[model samples]
Target: MAGAGSWFVEQPPAEPPAEASASFERLYRAFLSARAALGLALVMAQLISVVLGTTPARSTLALSLSYAVAALALWLAPQLRRGASARSLARISSPHWWSAIGVDLILFGVLHALDPSGVNYGALFVMPVLMAAVLSPRMLALATAAMATLGLLGAAAWSLLAGLDVGLKTTQAGLVGSGLFAVSLLAGELSARLAREEKAARGSLALARQQELLNRLVIDEMQEGVLVVDRRGRIRAMNPAARSLLGAASGELSWQLRGRADWQPLVLALERAYGGSAGEGGAEVDVALALDSGAARSLRLRLRFTRQREGSEELCVLFVEDNRELLARTRQEKLAAMGRVSAGIAHEIRNPLAAIAQANALLAEDVAGGRAEQLTRMVASNVQRLKRLVDDVSELAPGMQPDTQPLDVSALVQETCEDWVQVNGVEPGAQSRFRLHIGAPGLTGLFDAEHLRRILVNLLDNAHRHAEPGAGAIQATLDRHGDALDLVVRSAGAPVPHEIERHLFEPFFSTRSRGSGLGLYICRELCERHGARIDYRRATDAAANEFCVRLRTPSSASSA
Candidate 1:
């Protein structure tokens, strides 16, 4: 029996050989094409000599036929190359090139010898020898010149033997031989120089491509939206941030609109920026994109026209700046400063608050009256609220990360839901009020259990507060998988007001006075740390709201 390893072996992928580089293949094709054209010109030259009565009709016919046949063969070389394998194509060495130049030299020699009595068509021979010098290797070019010298001498000697030279045949052959050698030397050097410049240009282009890739990476990873459009307002390119800012979901027509009337507002902005030849927008403009969701987003887009270089497409680069983010960025710095000051004070406040809670407990034990007991309960409740406020601030301290590993998502969701149901006072037998729709129950993926727990608990806590008990049942769903895990928490509730919805995840922005307003913001930060995304959408059910968490590789997933 064959060994197990021998039975199952991995084969590396196949690739073309280096010599079969696209550059060489293209050069070969061009060389063949030029030769074909040279053949036609040769036929034309022969016909013209006959018309002038400088050459006989019989010689003209023979030369014309030879040139016609060679031209047909030259034209067919590219066609043959199309069917060859990479290795075989690269195997075509310098000798093949030399052979081709030899054939061309032979044709020129025949034409020269046939019309020795007529006008010297010797200048026509320069075309093929020069062609070989420009395209073939330096050694091959020298060889081509040597072969051409032999053909010239052979043709002149034939003319002398055929009663055609007078005394100038040898002199003419020597002068032409000198010209061939000089032409080869000069053309070969120039060709070598041109080849070096071309290689340098290719290297420069590779560097330019790398720079472009880096620019694309920076743009794609920006939190601010970026839209690159043409003068026609066609979205030439856009990052995922722009897509989400415009609420353009994947494969959506509105997301990828081209030259449509709906995108006119953006196009008009481009014209305003590039209106004059100066190509500068006087200032940023606030343009609203008409989203299909019926929510119009007013975006502050700063436009600058591309440097209009000739032979290049001109475009407009629109820097999409969100007004809310601009406002938030300025406030975030102030918040960070305040957080530092408050963190120092929170410790001092905690000790006094703990003392007051202890004193209230001791007083409750001493006083048996209804008023005293009620006062103690009130004191304890307020103290707990303050402590919770303190804890929320502590959680916000920077650089915190939860331990992560592969975990069962369905089990995590189920456990958090059960804990939330117990704490929030769901009716004793109303466990079924919370629904679990697990498409992949056995699925396991990377996640921090504590982080997932906090996220789920916060989501469920909000759901219970708004719609879980009474007639409304909260729904928790874990859906179709792979590396990506989708979990959604939804419940029937009054439609979230658009005004509040805009700032829903903004830190310290809360509708409820007693609430800390950090639940969703902290949830988002936690989700981001664990390579997950949290987004709230008005539920498809008109009376419901849904928050969806997508857990995937962080780089590919961006939070709205």
Candidate 2:
């Protein structure tokens, strides 16, 4: 059992996972930032060219208008980052990239036709750089090489056909420009591939680390001792939990028994229970073992076999769960027979003791001795105590069957809480900090309403008595567990001790001063009558200890 330490409180939502809007917003912002930087640089370059005395007014205006259009294109970049549609990337990058290049090409043609020798058109590298910025490196490299060749051919043809006196070897200049563009394209492709590969490698490394961490967590935190053995029963894998249970160290699989032996009796007992039926399908078996410490223990073990090859033998995986607690309870039933016999003998003696007390009361009235009066009082008190003990023992017997019908469990819980609030005299205006979590619709099921109410009322009363002083709050929640319903009531208080938890449902046992010791015992009896079970265990993961009631609906027998 967990110790009596207060933990922090948090109310988690009862809902499924939904699509994440924050991740989409982050991707959108990244796209906009990249596009904005490119558009701003282009606009600044156009302004600088116009401020200098090298470009004509009409050309300056055309560049300014093109920059304005490119600025507008930046707003649409976020849509391009969306990968849900198959053709989204192509539609976003290809249209805008080609449009910017087409505008630049038209402007270059117009300037050469107007004044062929004066325009310093080498700055046209900006168009290809913009293409590289918008699309991936591979597409940008191919587009740049094609655009450079076309520009060279168009310039040389125009110089001859339009009669412009541009005296130069146009093919040589074209070759030089195309060579520079090719070098830039190669550099971009290599850098992009390197970045992509590095990113993929990092992702894979992180994933591997995550899986390793998960494996260690499972090995350390699991309660069931897990062992993986080959067909020959040689130990292949054993987690830390298994090692601790088996009393083995890092490297010793075969060792002679000393004061502690974990292998022989436990394993042999399970095998014997299987009765040689451990070939293929999974089988569960229970075994009793006498440990070296003179304590007999029972374990519930499950074995599963998986064949490594078609012809090869199978490997058996064993899961051993400790069932010492249940075994102890089974033994306690024998010890309780003494109490049952004592109570029965007390009942047989009670009638004669009652007659003696009545006769003594009459004799005391006649004779007036104070000693007789004191003796009479003592005899009456002892008789009453014995009668009470016998009554407590009798309540342990099984009772009436459940009268079940379908009921709205949430509404019933709400009504119960409201009635409690009223009974406690809490004002309607006062703030109630208690949280109520009711599961969704169709949580209704057939159950005995009166019996369930009695169980809840008893649990609530028990919580109210044991709750901590300052944090006078209780939370009630309803949950659907497969086809059954679960009711949980939590209050701020110390956890019930382990010794108390073991006999919590046993009749005539309690921790209170004036309690009948039958509150929880009766609750369990009622729950069992309705085809359900009530149990008490410490809530190690909450701000306070919680007592949960699991109510399984009864399966109806068909009417013949």
Tens-place lDDT per residue, model 1, 1-560, is 11111001110221223522565556656766777777777677667877887665576567767776766675685554454332222122533543355566777788777763455767766866786666554555566678777887887788777877546766777788889889977876666555556656766887899999999999989988887776555677888888888765665432334545656677677776767553644357898777667777778887777777889888777788777788778799887776666666776788998999899889889988788888888998999989877766666666567565678877777778777777776654545666667775655645798878888887887786777344446888888455588888888778789988989887788877888888888788788777678999987746789999987633234332
TM-score of 2: 0.33
Angstrom error of the Cα, residue 370, model 1: value is: 17
Error of 1 at 198 (Å): 3.2
| TM-score quality measure for candidate 1 | 0.56
Each prediction's Cα RMSD?
A: 11.0, 22.4
Could you give candidate 2's per-residue lDDT for residues 1-560 as a string of tens digits? 11111010010221111212342234334544554564566566656775885454665455545555654564565454344211222232545434434444455444444443355454454454434422333444455545655665566667778775445637544764676466556555554454455446656887899999998788668877777665444676777666655556877553332324546765564355345756657678776656545666577767877755878766666777668754667766754674567556766776876787688677667756588778767776766665655554554433335677777777787778788767765444334535567887556756677667766777877777877654335667789886578898887777887877788887668787667677787687766666676666566766576778876643332221
- Scored by Cα lDDT, where does model 2 land? 0.58
Clashes of each: 0, 0
Off by over 4 Å in 2: 1-395, 426-430, 433-435, 440-442, 470-472, 537-541, 553-560
TM-score of each: 0.56, 0.33
lDDT of 1 at 9: 12
